[model samples]
Target: MTDATALVQHLNSDFSAGHDAVPARVNGTASPAIEQALAHPDLAEPIAAALAYAVVRARGAVRVAELGTCPADRVRPLRRAVERIATERAKAEAVCGPLRRPAQRASHRLGRSLKQTPARAVLPAAHRQTLVTACAELGLHADAFSVPNQRNGAWAQSRGLFGSVPSEAVRELAARDDTEFVAALLHDARMAEDERLGHHLIVERWNRLSATALAWGPYAIANAERRAVSRPLHARRDVLDALEDAYEDLAVLTCRAGEAKYRAFRLTCQVRELTVTGKRASVAAAAHRRAHELLQVSHPEELAEIAEAVRAHQVDCPFRADGCPDCQRVVLKGLSGQCQEAPGSRPEPTSPPQPTDASGPGVTYASFGAEERYAVLNDIPGGARVVVSDAAIGEDSALCGYGWAAEDGTTGHGDSMASTSGEAEIIGVCAAALTALTTHANDEFLVLCDSRQAVDAVQEVEEHGDVTRAQEAVLFPEAGELLTRLLPYAHRITVRWLKGHIGHDLNEAAEALAGLALRQARGRIAERTAHRARARTTSRIATQYLPRRSMPHAA
Candidate 1:
C-alpha cells in the first residue's frame, strides 16, 4: 500500500482495544545522551513515530504488542499494524505542532518505562479548550503543556479549585493575554526557588515559533549596521558624518522621554563610542605600517631618515635604538650608557661597594664561606630585622628551614615536612614570620624567601586576603592563616624575594638547615615504608595455614 493510504487505514482501526502497550517514563525524562541522539535531523521520523506511540498509550487510546510475544498471537497483519501506528502519530503531530529532535517528546517510549504511571487530574473539556485558545493568541503552541512528562501538580495548583478551575478566574485570565495569567499562576504557586521556570515555560514556546522568522528580519539589519561602525577599516568619515545628522533627525522625531527616545539616545551613544575606538585603531594601524616600511630599509642613511620622520610624527620607534643593529650603527654613536649588542663586547659600568662595619663583634654563621663577600652581618640598631628561609625536595620526601639574624645574633630552626619543594618554601616562610611576630613584638619584620612563587603567594595573602596565583605552593593557605593571626602582634610585616645559593650568610645558614631537614624527612619516610612492608609479609605468613585449635571438628 502507498504511505498515505496506509496512514489513513491505521487511523480507522480501533486503537483502544489492546491493554499491553508500553508506557514511556512519566514526565519525559530522557538522559542527556539519548536526547542528543533524538535531536539529529536524520532521526526525527523514527523519533516522532516513537513519541506518537507513547502519547497514544498515555491517553489510554491504544496498545501495541508487548516485547517477546508469541508469533501465533502477534501474527495477525504486519501491514495493518504499521498503518495504525502511522495514523496515531499523525494525530499526535496535529496536537503537538511539531516534534523537533533533541527536545524530549513527552511521548518518547524507548528510554525509561514505568508500570501504571499516574495520569494528570482531568480538567473540563471546555476549560481545556479555553486555555489552549488563550495560549494561541499569545503565540504559544497548545502542545507545550502536553509535551514530555506531565506536570500535573503545577496544573492542579494553578487551577486552584481541585479537579476543576473556577469559571470566574478562567474568564478573567483569558481576557488578559499579555503575561498576566501565567504571572498570577506563578504567584499563587510561590515557587521562588527557581524564578526562571515561569519565564522558560512562556519564552521557549514563543521562541520556537519566532526564531527562524526573526533571523532574517530585524536581526540581520542590526548586525550589518554594527559591523560597519565597529570596524576601523569599514568605518568611513563621510558615513560617520551622515550618521550624526541622522541621529539628530531621529531625536527630533522622538523628543519625548519614553522607550523610543531612550532607545535613540542609547544608539547615538554607542555610535559615538565606536567612532572614538575606530579612530584610535586607525592610528595604531598607520604606526605599524610605517614601522614595517622602516624595518625593510637596509641602508643606515635611509633608516635614519625614516626614524626622523617617525619622531616628527610623534610615534616611538618600534625597535630599541641601542639594541637594534641597524639603529645602533646610526642612532647610538658615542653614547656612554649605550648597550652592547652582544654580551661581553663592552665592559658594563658597576657601582662602588658600600662601606660596612663588619669589624664590630657579632656571632658568625658556620655555613658562610671565608670569602670577604660573605662578611659577618653586624648588629644594626633598628626597629626591624631580617630572616631568611629555604626548602629542598628529595625523591622520597621534602623539608624546610629558616634562620634569623637580629641585634642579638643568629638563631636557626629546621623541620621535616610531608610536601613538595614549593610547599616547603612557603612553610619555611610561615615559620619565620611566626617566630618574628612572637619573639620581637615591638619590632618590624622582614622575611627573605628563596622561591619567587612562594614569596608572591605570601604577599598575595597580605594584600588580597587570599592566595590565588600559586597552586603548587600548598602551604600558602596555612601561611596566610598564620600571617592573619600575627598581624596584630607585629609592628610591621614584610615579605621579600631573595636569590638562593648566594654567599649571603643568613641565606647560607637557612640552606644548611633545609638540607638537614630533607635528610631527616627522607629517613622517616623510608622507615615507615619498610615497617608497612614487613607487617604485610608477617600477616601473609601467619594466614598461610589455619591454626590447629581453630580447625573445624572432623565429621
Candidate 2:
C-alpha cells in the first residue's frame, strides 16, 4: 500500500481505540469536537492528514528514543518532514485565515493529550534559552515577523536613546551586528543598575565582567530589554549611557567578543597541525634509518638502486627545499643529495600509521603452556622485567609526548600529535606494552601505567572473553589496536594501574623522559617553522627585485 493509505489506516485505528477521547472514558468513542471537525466535508481530508502526520511523527520520535543514538544521515530527512508539515500548515492558514474556533479547540485538546506522551515530555528549564535562541535562528516561531521585530526594535530604541551622548567607539560598537557584544553590554548595564553604580564606576571596573558573566549575557538580554521598556525614559537613557561607556572600555580590554576562548581554540589547532607535521617527520626518519641499514650490506650496484627507491619514496616536510632534517641526516652518511627528492615529492603521502600493534615488529609465537619454555625465552632475550610508562604535554609548546622506562635500563620516548593529555597517556601505555611484547614475546611482563582510563580499557577488553569480539567492542582506534596486539599475549602480559607523582622512581623517570621528548619536539617544530619563513621571505624578495628577462619578439 502507498504510505498515505497506511498512515490513514493507522490514524483510523488510533481514533477507533479512543486513545485521545475527550474526558478519556473507558468506552471507545471520538470526542465531540473531533467528530464535528471531521463531519465538515471541507475540513475532513485536511484534519485526517494532519492527525496522520502527528501520529507518524510521534511514533518516529519514540523509535529514536528507543534506539538511544540517532544516525546523522537520518537527521536531515526528519527535519525535512517537520519542515514539510510546517509549510503545509502555513499554506492552509493562509487560505483559511486563523483556524476556526471548533478546529482550534480540537487542536488544543490534541496538544494537551500529546503532552502526556513520552515524545512531548517537557525539557529542563536550563535549556529553555538555548532552545529559544535556536528557534529564533531557524525562524520556527508561529509569529516569526513579530518576534524578530520585537528583538530588533528593542535594541534600536536603546541605541537611539544614547544619541550622540557616547563616544565614537561606543557608537561604532552599537552599529556592528555582534549580538554577543551587544548582549554583554546590556548585561553589564543591568548589573550596574542593580548595584546602584554610576557610569564612571562601571567604566573603572569594566574588566570585572568575567567570562562566566559574559556566558550568561545572551540569555539575560531579553529580560533586560523587557524590563527596560517598563522604566522611565530618563532611567533607560542612563542605563544605555552606562552600557555604552562600559563597552568603550571593554573594547580596549578585549578586541573581540570571546577573544580568550577563540585564541585558545586557534592555538589548539596550531598545536595539532605541528604535531601532525612532526609525526610525518618521524616516519621519514624511520625510512631513512632503514635505507642506511640496507646501504651498509648491499653491493655497489645495489647502492644506486637503493638510492633510486629512496628518491621515489614520498615525504611531507615543510622544509624540503632547505633540506628535510631526515634527508640531511642521510646526506651526512655519504648518500647522494638526490635522496632529498624523496622528501620533496609533490603528491600526498599515505596516512601515517596509527598507534597499533601492526605498526610495530611482528610478534613471535611460543607455547605459553610450558613455564620452562617461557623462562628460556626470557633468559635468552634478557628483556626488562618491569616497564613503567607515562605521558606529558608541554604547557607552553602544547606538544604531546610519551616515555617508557624498563628495569633493565632500557628507555624509550617519542612525540605524538595527540590533541589531549588523556589520549597521550593511552598512547604511552600502548607504546610501552607493544615494545615489551615484541622484544620478549614469550616472557611474562608486568606493565605499570598511571592512567586509570587506560587500565580500565584494558580490563574491559580482557573481560570480553572472545578476542575478536573484544577488539570490536573498543571504539577508539589507538586503544583498539593496543588491545588487538596485547590480547594475543594476555597469558603472559599483565597491565596494572599505579598512582602517579608520589616519587615512584620508575614513574618519575618516565615522566622526565616524556617532558624531555616534548621539549625536543618543540625545538624541532620551531626550527622547521623558522626555515619555512626564511624560504618564503627569500622567494618574495627574488620575485620583487630579480629582473625578468625580456621575451624574444614573436616574428
| Candidate 1 segments exceeding 4 Å error | 1-382, 396-407, 416-419, 467-472, 475-491, 524-555
The C-alpha local distance difference test score for the whole of candidate 1 amounts to 0.39
Model 2 lDDT tens row, 1-555: 965454445544443332243112112355554454333444433443343334334333432322223465766666565455445445544544343333422322221111111111122231234334433544434221111212222332342322335445544543544444444554543443222111221221222333323333322222232233345444565444433333333322222223232233333333223321443334323332333333334334434444443354324545556433233333323333323322223555799642222213332223223212112122322333567788886431224668876655556677654434665676787788778767665666667777777666666666674434533223235445666776766666566666576555567667876776665554423435544543443344334323432211111
Weakest ten-residue segment in model 1 by summed lDDT: 112-121
- CA-lDDT, candidates in order: 0.39, 0.43
List RMSD in Å for every model shown. Answer: 32.0, 33.4
Q: TM-score for each prediction?
A: 0.27, 0.27
Q: For model 1, how does the per-residue alpha-carbon lDDT over 55-131 read when each residue is reduced to its tens digit?
A: 32222111112111225345345434445555655654454334432122222211111100000011123323543
lDDT of 2 at 300: 40
